[model samples]
Target: MIAEQPKTNTAASKAMAKPLKRGRACMTCRILKIKCDGVRPICGPCRKNPKEEECEFSDGPTRSRTKVLEETVSRLEARLQELEHPDETTPSVTLHDPYSPYHDSRQLSKHPSTLLMPDSRLFTPLSPFSPTSATSSLPSGRQWTSFGLEAKSDSVTSSGSSSSPHGHHASSPFLGEEEPSFGIIQNLVDNFLPHASEFGFFLNTNRFRHATLLPLPFGHHSRPSRSLLSAVYLWGAHLSQSELLLAQEHTLMIRALQHTATDIMGPHPDAVLHTLQAEVLLAYYLFQTGRFLEAKTHAATAVSLALAAGFHKIRTSNLHPQPMIGLSSETPISLHPPHDNIEEGERINGFWTVLMLHKYLTIALEPPTSVCGTLEAPGTQIDTPWPLDITNYSEGLLHPDVRGSNTIRNFLVNIPEQGYQGQSVLAMNAKAAILFHRSAQLSGQWTPNLQPREFQSFAAVFQSLNRLIETLRHSLTPLAQLDVKNPYTRTIVLTHALTDAATIKLHSIFSYSDSSSKQHCLTSARNMLAFAGFNIQDVGYLNPIIGTLWMTACHVFIDEISRLRSMHTAWPPNTEGSEDELMERLRSGMAVLNTLSDESSLGKYQLTKIQEAFSAI
Candidate 1:
């Protein structure tokens, strides 16, 4: 055979060399500098290197599902981090322990998997979002259900203004004081509850930024309370953004919340209630991160909190109709009309209304309205019309007293109707109007058209989001007298961040829709920063949002650096050559997305959705 074996066939020769074929390697393999069969973007070579001849596929038997999930989650987190916080100068910290003084008092806790008690306050100041009348007689309207479905419920009339349910803590601006402690739960009753320490956990900065952005007003209380030492430690560990990192951290959070909810947080009513809210918020962030099931779990927990607060056993404030999250029997929530200050009571009512609306949106089923053995039949069926309602939730911004809260109508009233800021609002409104009008024009249905008059009820919510944006814009320009870096609360700034992020998401629909009025949408988006106090054209994260949001996981990091810089008193860099920079950033982001527009990946799929969606425009 050695002397004269016929030459091997070309096919055999080719087959022998096939395993050595060179192709683009997996991102990991390329970076690791290992010999990759250059698998054609995830091929045999990529899966099992030729030299190693080792098939790494777990499909062969005995592979652990938990390990796969953990690895999958880790990869996602790393990618998200890479997309979000690219810079290292500033970072956000998560509050692992409520007592840790290292964090700001306003930001108390955010343990992703660990559930904490909701702000005890959401309970007592009972102000349900139901109509002021005992019965709403208006025609039933279309409303968006929590699951994003359209449904109608009977509208029940609300009764007269109910008195504050918490007579115990009445008349006090705030009770004497809360005891200070570290690494343990501080009980409000006669005893100290050390249980909170059981669920305490911290997240790195990259992980923290992946969570939801707090709107203004809420941000005042949220940001400071969250600045803890452990939080700082976690944040400082990683300055740059990494998608793989964010996904992994988020996985950590989900696991933590899941663990806390099942084992540590839910046995007690009060703890369960708070944990519900925390879980809900965390879930909301996960949804934003494209993690649906985890988001659903958190949302369900939040609803469960509402169910507990509305338990037939507890008394509720008539003014606040929604289920209270963490009201405790030991310390009843303080809900009372101040003899000298009706305004404060109203403010509390406003807060309750917001909470209730949140509840209504998060969980489809509304809790039965029962307060203090006062067995009133739970409010009307959702489909019933309640036009005679005393308060229009959608119009939350219009109230004159919103001076205390950042409701919608309050902010829009002062827009110099014809000026640039006003112009932005007008354009936004016009675009919105066009959206509804066009929907009506095409399908001959008014309102969101997704539902008849029901979505109209959401007009208020839309208005509120718009107001949120306006307040954020105004907040951007600190009084020339106040320190720009350390303006008090910066409630406006935070609100702007949250609302801006939200609007970007909301309008992403338009990016894909062919619009006779895209200029309006794009312009309004640009003006978002102006409303908050920046040219927007110059801001790094906010600037690129115009086009990057739909493509390249860019949505995650857009405002991270600016937020960190602002939170820490560091000056955020000014964008040089504003227009040029914006255009360039847009180009890079758009190019990545366009490349993906033809390719396949989670990030690419999302952008393609935007592109295809806008084709109608």
Candidate 2:
């Protein structure tokens, strides 16, 4: 037996000496920097602490989730610092706590997490390419209760300078006694409130009215935030039909914006939602007043503030049954405010309004300078759900039984019954805008890149767009289509016109020699002209993009007509639209341009271009 044992198994020893290929560490161990025996659903550490369910493992040897989150936090901290101390050369560092004037960079370095709320985990960065997978990392646990930074006191004053510590300059225009009288405030609301929603302004009229009753602490006035109140009155003055109000609209707007600018200098502007609201209204005012750059800047700031407040993510009221290891067993924890339906509805509406504005801005800012864009443009990614109707949300309806989904992305991914619910006018317009954006992107790339992959991609997208158009068309009822008196009529007309514009752009990409593509382009151009032709006077005022759509259609029509004429077809061919019909369409498009030529310099420039093209044909 001893002689047989002496013969060692070298293969077994070698196998034992080899290192084990360990799986990626779970999220819990990665955060704690401890070794993890990787397991499914529950890792070794998470298994011991059942409440650590957020523990997840990567598929490969990639950076752990904790590291990614830490990096994101670091970036955000830098961004916040930059926003607070825009002029970094200034000696007085902006501290979060208004009570304490002393600056301490050491505090931020020692406890960086202090600036982050307990539920900071919810601020997970999402990739545009993998949006669905991005959501998996954002496991809900607790409601975000803290503002994550100290609140600036109203009474605090900065040292070494006459400027107030609340972050206002000594010479701030808001410090003046230029307050609007009660009559002026009432007049402004009367003029603005009725037409506000028509242009995608989502400020709650009831809330504004209530705010007007609250007296300011600093002055004997019946208004809470002077800046916000001024903005309301300013917009009212601009929209006022009264000659007196219109004469002072510019001065009022400048004064209102000056008051709002002071609020921006505060320690943490994003902490207060009302500040964001004021910024948005100001942005809209700037837009209507033809101040594009300033409006865009204000809108961008509002979007950043909204994102900081986590408004892009859908807020739900349901509680997580799995409590953390230390929380009380009897009492459940809530992450969001309970029974605040109005605030929730406002967030929903606000997010979508900004998203739509961003899309409009992008279309406007794109090349070809004559085209006018939407009033407000936010340079931020939008991942919010489609806003429900005001009635449904205001009535305390948490969720509704929709056909397919709630999010705009999901709606596009899987077309809902008849595009979307007919009642949701906002959703309809958003979908149409999405299609138009895709068309613009596709056209931009088509000419430069003639690669096989590009063609294949465009072909696939174009086909999908056609299906979406069909779905949109089916969603509209005969009654809705013809109801010219309804406010929603403008939305419907613009949506259809944009859809046809997108179609024309897509079809125009194909070779002009290709008979089928040329015919499709001609048909789409005709459809766009027809859609925009109805109530042309009203459409121009409803949206600024109508002129661009008309111009695009005219170009397509002219190109097709020129092609047909070159082929020696004297009579109007039955295969294509008649020459007389094409000519009529062209004339109708010109009429719209001529009508809007005096509205702005852009309008006049667009009309000139169209006439030149028409004369050449």
Per TM-score, the best of the predicted structures is: 2
Compose the digit string of candidate 2's lDDT tens values, residues 332-451: 222234246666666677776766665655665556323232322343233445665655567645454322223554555663433324347666777777777666766665554568
C-alpha-based local distance difference test score of model 2: 0.57
State the number of backbone clashes in model 1. 91
Candidates' lDDT values, in order? 0.31, 0.57
Candidate 1 vs. true structure, TM-score: 0.31
Per model, state how many residue pairs clash. Answer: 91, 2
How high is the lDDT of residue 120 in model 2? 26
Write out the backbone clash pairs for model 2. Answer: 143-335, 158-165
**Which candidate number would show the highest lDDT if scored against the true structure?**
2
lDDT of 1: 0.31
Q: Which stretches of candidate 1 lie over 4 Å from their true place?
A: 1-251, 263-270, 307-494, 497-519, 529-617
What are the RMSDs of all candidates, in order?
A: 25.9, 22.2
Tell me how far the alpha carbon of residue 207 in candidate 2 is from the true structure, in angstroms, after superposition: 3.8
TM-scores for every candidate against the unseen true structure: 0.31, 0.58
